[model samples]
Target: MRHYYIYLLKPEIASNYFGKEWLIYQLFVEGETAKKDLRTIAQKQINYISGTIPTLQIKKNLDKALRIRNDFYVLKEHYYIDIKALESKAVLKDHGNMLTISASGSYQAETVFFEVLRQINPAFFAMDFENRNYGWLNPVKQVNYI
Candidate 1:
């Protein structure tokens, strides 16, 4: 079943990787939420099945990091449609949980997610990849547990 899982980024990693003291990734996964899958998804920003990230967030800085920048823009409208679908379903709660991003929140969770991707300098991202020890550790929250 598809659900949400919150992975807390390690403090130092959060600082160095995302330039933030505290960062959490609340991911929507359809299968078993493995750290490996989370790391891969977070690192690549590409959809697990479709192998693509939403194109709207890409900019010059992030563009430089992508191997195929042109590929992103091809499906820009599809993602917005997906977001609208999510909004219609009320998949992202707007009221109860402060931790959850509201459907109408100025900073959508997906934006923060991609922003985290953009925050890392290409050089640092490359060096860190060599270590194979990413910051996405144990999940702090899971819908099943909660």
Candidate 2:
């Protein structure tokens, strides 16, 4: 079994025109080093998925950490697609802005997941095989013969 993870990056800083708080939604997909630079893969994912991008309102003196909560809402909504597909057959770990999903099956599922993530944001992505524990912790579990 192989696992694929996705992390959404929220805007860390905002401009004065936006009142020092701007929310940018980015998607990070795990695995498949070769297709990461491809743009068509992302477009295909969007054509298949259903959802709207979330909106945020920033208030004065709001703590930067608070923005994470808002980002979770967006993540939660996006995560549902995978949840519906895998159901209890997979394990899911939510670490604020990051989500780790694991399932038992061929690598095709991972490819599809990556496509979806790319569809969300082609600019935000990182791949790691060794340093998986450094950032946010979100894990999903699955079982299958690989």
Candidate 3:
């Protein structure tokens, strides 16, 4: 069985800054050898996750975080989880890994899940959150690779 590292980010308290508010980020690292490239993998992952921001300071911090370690920190308002995907159902080999984002209120929880649909897939997209009643009634937004 292939090995994978699953990371999850959950918000401590939901805010109204961005629509539904809950903000979370997850990453999956595959292969036994993939751990050796964690830093590079993390850099690519962060860049892919952060979207395009017009400022250099944010970019620098993102780069710095990725280059340094496996365990990185977000703001004080979020939570994180890093686990090994061991079972078939537990692992989403298609997109990379699964990321679940949850918020604190009644606005419907936004879950941005991902998987490696194909072993050599080039892009990423968001799957539905596990629970639909936590935030908005509409479908979760699809975030494609930039």
Best by TM-score: 2
lDDT of 3 by residue, 1-146 (tens): 22222232122111221243233222322221246677577656544443321224323433453335333234442322232232112212222233234333222111111211111121223323333122221323444578
TM-score of each: 0.19, 0.30, 0.18
lDDT (C-alpha, whole model) for all candidates:
0.29, 0.32, 0.29
Identify the runs in model 2 with alpha carbons over 4 angstroms from their true place. 9-94, 126-146
Model 1 TM-score is 0.19
The CA lDDT at 135 in model 1 is 30
Kindly give the stretch of ten consecutive residues in candidate 2 with the minimal lDDT sum. 14-23
Q: Which scores better on lDDT, 2 or 3?
A: 2
lDDT of 2 at 113: 40
- Using TM-score as the measure, name the better of candidate 1 and candidate 2: 2
lDDT (10s digit) by residue, model 1, range 1-146: 12222233333443444532122222222122557866676544313211222233333334454334222221331222123433321122112111121223232434433343435322111111222222332222222434
- Sliding window of 10 residues with minimal summed lDDT for model 1: 93-102
